[model samples]
Target: MKRLYQTVPTGCDWAVEAQGLVKTFGDHRAVDGVHLKVRTGTIYAVLGPNGAGKTTTIRMLTTLLRPDDGSARIFGYDVVKESHIVRQLIGVTGQYASVDESLSAIENLVIFSRLLGMGRKEARQRAEELLEEFSLTEAANRPLKNFSGGMRRRLDLAASLIAQPPLIFLDEPTTGLDPRTRNQMWETIRKLVNHGSTVLLTTQYLQEADELADRIAVIDRGKVVAEGTADELKASVGNSSLQLKIQHSYDMERARQIVEQVLKVRSNTSTETGRITAPMTEADRVTDLLIALREAGIHLAELSVQKPTLDEVFLTITGHGVKKDTAVDSSSAVEEVRV
Candidate 1:
């Protein structure tokens, strides 16, 4: 099976490199000629809707499945020919939390550390260190069944880091968590990168990618439709809008009128958000709008220049919004891999 994708090797400084990667299942081309070059010690995010070939791409790069075409390298080692070496350099946290339901947090980390060839005493020490790092020291002795969602996630992350691999693959690590827990996980990921780990993250949440990714690649129908930093991608949309919120409801109509008269373009008002949004045709439109509004005595609660959202970007790329129902879970994705 390994021989299928194994080919001539290449050299690279990237923490991860894949070129023209392809995968198929019977008639389905789950992954289609995807290419990715992730810089070392930074976070790269892959975001797409359900069944968008995200999981299949991850499986190929992780050496869990042979690609139908193309090649991938991990830290300059070919994923296929040097799979053992590749695996040695990386750790994976799947979409779902993988900690043992019955094991205590400390026990889980200890076992993982021991498996990474630590001695009993060394394992114990490492376990304690990780427990503190993840802020789970208080629950270290409690069975994981009693742990909250956030604690379990942190523990799962700690276990995956037992070997301190240089590169980590996280597939939707924040799925199914509340906003607070999700934020905590985001911080943990940032801390990992700060301490010198390169992360390749796949997620359905646009905001997650916006907040955490140093670079984002959007995949659809197994193709990379776009790739750039959040700001770069937004700027690529090629238009900015003057966004204004008036302090009083009575000022909405006046504010709208002032914006339309200044920009010479129709403005929209959202009753829900009380915002007047209009596209800016000139470079100084927002500034012009501000001065005009102030002259007219329209006090604003908020004013800013706005670009298209990641959500809007995705819609433009894929011709639809993300369908959470179409999202393939990790376990199901793994099971669908063809040899």
Candidate 2:
């Protein structure tokens, strides 16, 4: 297949690169030998379940936590030796809202701008422009304590972009948001890329990574177990399958029997979707199934080919579904960790 974007033609093309990155706390290895090569002007997702060492990796890449081993560069600057330069080029935001509750929306943005070395007039102008861009101008003067979760999330992102950094690190920025709000956050991330920014995202929401990331690295047990585009990862797990909705509950048994005999593989059905799925191949075709079912006097409500999902890919690679945890001190630990 044709490549989607141009490969890095020169040494300066990468936005972030690392090799053999390892971090340990006493006997525990939070991040073990993690590596990455993120391109310029695209979204790269580090996808993993909690306690999978995602936050520890971000800390090393952003120069917040010193790595016990390995090294990394951000747009040609060393994360450790040249951390000051790295800081100037990148923005980091995490799960928690970082704005002061007592401050107004405009006030929060202006403060960030000021901290970034903007003069009084410049800071005010930048804050106003960002408030407008993020669609928060209507509530710019309202205290942050009154802002909704979505509004506060947007404001936090705006603050991170105050200096217009070339690269941004978003550590699960959409966790705990309503569907509409999550979509809004996704749009905001896309807008950042459209404006010539490179983003490195860490997320457990498989769908979020599937939607936003141009490429993905699935981390399990503090190391990258898989890396590719969403489709590539999904394709790696298994083949596309045929999904059928039986017209009646009684038809399910007959359909399953016909499908098994035709495909020579076991079939699985779900009570929730009222669907049965089996691997799709030329030998197990819709026409053949329909013909066989017609002779057997069985009917199906729907039939379609379905590809594997990222969630399925995760379970396949990791051997289990992701277990949720909120304990900050644990291996999963991610909540606005800063530099």
TM-score of each: 0.71, 0.74
Which window of 10 residues has the lowest lDDT sum in candidate 1? 1-10
lDDT score, candidate 1, position 228 = 69
**Cand. 1 Cα-lDDT:** 0.77
Clashing pairs in 1: none
The sequence of per-residue lDDT tens digits that candidate 1 reaches over residues 118-222 is 888888999999999888889889998888776777888887787788888998888788998898899989998998889999988767888999988888889
lDDT of 2 by residue, 1-339 (tens): 221122223457789988779999999999998878888999999999888999899989999999999889898889999999888888898668878999999988887888788888888999999999989999999998888888988998998888778889998888788999899889999998998889999998767898999988888778877777776565444456678898888777778889867765456677667788765535336677779888998877888887655445555555432222211122221111111
TM-score of 1: 0.71
Worst 10 residues of 2 by lDDT: 330-339
Q: Which regions in candidate 2 have their CA more than 4 angstroms from the true location?
A: 1-11, 238-307, 319-339
